[model samples]
Target chain A: MNTLRRSVSLIALVAVAACSKKQPPAPAPAPAPAPAPRVNQDSIDRANAAKAAAAAEAERQRLAAATAAEASRLDAARTAARAKLGMVIYFDYDKDEIREDQRVTLDAKVPILNANPDVKMRIAGHTDDRGSDEYNLALGQRRAAAVRRYMAARGVADGRFEVVSFGEQRPASPGESEDAWAKNRRAEFEITGGGTALKVP
Target chain B: MIKSARLLCVCCVCGLLSGLTPAQTRAQDTAVASGVRIGLTYDRHGKPGIAITPVSGPNADSVRAILIRDFDFSDRITVIAPDSGEPPTGALNYPLYAKLLATTVVQAVVTPAGALHVAVHDVAQKRVALVLDIALPTPAYSGDWRAVVHAAADSIEWIVTGQKGIAGTRVMYARNSGRSTQLWTVDSDGANARPVAGTENAMSPDWHPSGKKIVYDLLPDDGRHRIVVRDLTGATPTWSTGAASLNFSPVFTPDGSKVVFAAGNDATDLYEASPGSADPPRRLTSRKGSSNSSPTFSPDGRRIAFTSGLLGHPEVYITDADGSSSELLTASGFGDRLFRSNPAWSPDNRLVAFQSRINDVFQVMTISVRDNSTRQWTSDGANEDPSWAPDGRHLVFVSTRTGTKELWVLDLDTSRARQLTHGGRVQNPAWSPRLELSRQP
Candidate 1:
């Protein structure tokens, strides 16, 4: 019974000492700067360097793809802007009044014009090879003026539009038929300024 | 000798017995020079017979042929073949030509030193009526030959009719060939055609009174039409209105000191500009609700005839030089309102010619200023842009009778029309004034 008591007391003391070694005083705080093993630290440093290099290469590829995409987008936008500006609105024979069907064309221009305040356009009026040249000039002027007035009414400033008339002088079609004449009597829009920076969404 | 004496006696007796008036005396003198007797005179339909002898030199045949063709085109004389039996040199045998009833005999000879001697013999007068000696540097070329022969024909015409011929003058017009329109000038007989203006798509060319300059409208690829005054003497643009809202149908005033044209943005009206002047253009017409254009000054330079839509339809209107006293000139002639444009005042100041639309087809017509009697001059195809010749008896206009637009000249006396230009769409033929002697080539 004595031997058993001694052994139990010794085991308890060893257990207490192990606990104390594992759990030191709370005030002791000097372990953050301790150096790791040299061999293991070298391997860890090489791994981190490789990972960082991979990440940089990935970032460069991403930038190149983004730049190409941006260029393609800008090219497509320029083409679309040119097409929009090239849209022509036809008119009837010996008439300067814009028809109802042509309003849709004019309406499409309003947004583009409003979005680009720096854009300036020339509204040119052309007539079929009918009537006197002088009379045709006046008719073309009236047609161009009608277009300009419509745009001005639709929030476009008057200063942005330059109206001109080419009476029976410039024909869209060379034929003398009614269909050709109809195509010839038209109002065309030409972007005279700020075309280089045009963006179409 | 006896025949000559008898001829002189007969002429004196005829002069005394006829007791002719001044006009009649002039006609008789022309008939005597032509070798036609007074009683056996040719009627208006019958032209005086002329004989052009074969000239002996290089390219003489071509020169003679040109002379024959020109005389035939004159519409006042007939060319007869040379008699088979005739003297080759010296004085002509008037009796032989008299037997053939030839009125005038022309003898042309080319000297060795590139000179041409032309003699006109009057069979009835039994003497030489006129003589001309011209020096030609290049007699072998057709152009030089034609010029010399034209000069000789002009002299003959003057001696016979007391009026100069139009062979030496030129007519400027616009020609479009499915691609572009260019201004060109052709001789009255339609030879030596060449472009005058460098700008393409040119139209409505009007010659200055001096015949040294031309004013026209140029439509560039940029779709801007402007008035351009080109100097033919220097082959350069003396003045141009540049790019305007609308500038067209420019015409020189009678004095040629200013050019009146149509200019506007919304509504075109008449405006005058003095070429080479720093002053801006002066506005002439300002009628509201009316687009006035086609301004043509009168021969007196005091009045202007233009086309106005003030009456709901295009019609001819006359105004003072200051654009006041506007009067409607074509309203009373047409029963109903018709589209009348391209008003060109007659050089004689007696009539105004314009194109009137009837049944949707345009025809050239003229209305008398004094009596208001309208006469239709063209009925075939669509005819527009009538311009009067300097003589006031001929008109040059655009006609589509041959299925294409071409220039045609109409004679007021015979009511006949002759096509001038071949190939290409030609229009707005403005006949230049009588060219000075120095201007003829």
Candidate 2:
């Protein structure tokens, strides 16, 4: 609005001048625009410097965040692989013989064992509360031995495994239900040595 | 034909069963508690009816109550009711007890000198058969004197029947605590139940022949269980297997010379060593693929009866003490499956008591060693781990008949079971041999 007002006033002044001269007036050349207020060269350079610094800082933070997330993901994957190496395999009632369905679980451990020959494992057998603790101790040993035997047959070295039986003492679940009993009759694996760095199979 | 059932009602009220809690057994003498009929174990037709006469003096009521309960629990010598009225003030009217169908009468009087003056009178002979001056520990209702009273009762049974009773014995078992089973000892009558000192993780305790020590398997967290021998007196250092990977189901040779236990990390097998020495134990069972455990020495210590998981399921087997000539004792089938374990050879060496699975429930049964005749003693619930009283006619076992696992004593002749423990989930009862703290009549 100000610019337009200035322009209108300037045109009026020109027309008045032409009328006072008492000569035929045509559209005169528009007057030259006034000069902008002067700013120093150093000030312009300072503004450019601040903008560039802000952009660099934002880019650096994005790179750090991405790096942290990648490290965390790798850590979680290693932990999961180590836990899988110590997985539990369950059994049928009063049976030490491994079921066909559970073979996949044992099969999963073989490659992990093979990948890390230095690793030593402890395989413990357990039972439901159905039988005598003494008898269950024997039964648990059989189940654990059965597991160890399977691992050995699959090329796991005999020296790399330790077998034990907890009988019905250490149950995976509590109470007297079919589900609890089924969960209790199992062979559990634990890494005895060389477990710090697990190679996922 | 005695009214055994009617008296049994009073006996139950009196907590006549062996392992009922003390609070249950202490509710004694409801007027009819005086006359529980006892049946002699050896004789079938001659029950040998006996009357426990009323006594006089300090703790007379306590003395008479314990005496009568011991005889009633003897499962020998029929206990008849005393005469309705007292005999003439000075003397006992033997004729009255005889008229009550009592073949023998036990007259006890707590004398002024802290002695239970007892006389065993044969009613037919009309003469005093034997006299016992048993020292009566004052304040009999509590403390260890009850054991003395029980011993006095055993003496009476001994003199009258010519065979001693196991009234003075105690039962050892493991009671489940927080995460572990603790060692426990209770009187044979289910009185004086207390945990053995510092045996919180012990399982399956067996009594030493001398009754001065116990052997059990210590359950540690590392899966390296060891057989531990602890002296009850605590005067001697404890003995244990320092190297075995899994040692359990420990028992002492009947002669107290050696300890027999099972060790397995490779395969379950029996092992033996000097009970108090640190010598390496020699392996007893050689079967590699099978689990051979629960070793029980026969009476003469020449043979062992154990549970073997050789053929898919556990079965009872007898082998020489040298671990040779293993023979299957329980081979016949209930229905194509044989699940028998927890073998306890009788003290008389004639019967082997074990648990057999029937309909998925284990029941205590006895197999005659001589003839292979099997008799099932428990039916209502899962009953296993049968340990015999030294008398060979009674047994202590783990039974779930009452809904919780408990220790129960079974009279083989009467097929009667007495609950020995009501604590939380008890198992593996080992009845101690007769603690002969008193003179044999």
DockQ leader: 1
Task: Evaluate residue B8 in candidate 2 and report its C-alpha lDDT on the 0 to 100 scale.
Answer: 15
User: Model 1 residue B77 lDDT?
Assistant: 68
Q: Which stretches of model 1 miss by more than 4 angstroms?
A: A1-56, A63-71, B1-46, B81-88, B99-101, B137-145, B177-179, B197-201, B242-244, B332-337, B439-441
At residue B94, give the lDDT of candidate 2. 72
The residue pairs in collision within model 1 are B34-B103
Q: Native contacts retained per candidate?
A: 0.53, 0.47
DockQ of each: 0.35, 0.34
Per residue, candidate 1 scores C-alpha lDDT tens digits across B1-441 of 001211211010000001111111122111212322223233435666777776776555655655665565566665665524343676677898776667888887777886777777787998887666666534243333444456666666655555556655668898876446788876666655667636468888898987777899887766677788876755568788854577888999999999999887667778989999878898888887567888888899999999988876688999999888999988765655368999989988999999998767688999988888899999899899999887687888888899988888887877867777777578778988876444133
Top candidate (TM-score): 1
List model 2 lDDT by residue over B1-441, tens digit each. Answer: 001211110001111112212322455532334336443222324667778766788877767777776777787777764535452255567777666777788777878887777777788888877776656443454434666677667766776677878777889898875367788887777766777777877888998887877899888766668788887647443788846556789899999888898887756899999965767899988998888899998999999999888876789999999999999999785555478999999998899999998988888888989999998888888888999888889999888788888888888888766777876588889998777453222
The 10-residue segment with the lowest total lDDT in model 1 chain B:
B9-18
Report the lDDT of model 1 for residue B307.
92
lDDT by residue for model 2 over A1-201, one digit each (tens)? 686566567777867775787655656757544222112333466677777777777777777777778667757776776767778999999988999999998888888789888899888888999988898988887888888888899999877987787889888898889999999999988899998777665
Winning model by lDDT:
2
TM-score of 2: 0.81
Cα lDDT listed for each candidate: 0.73, 0.76
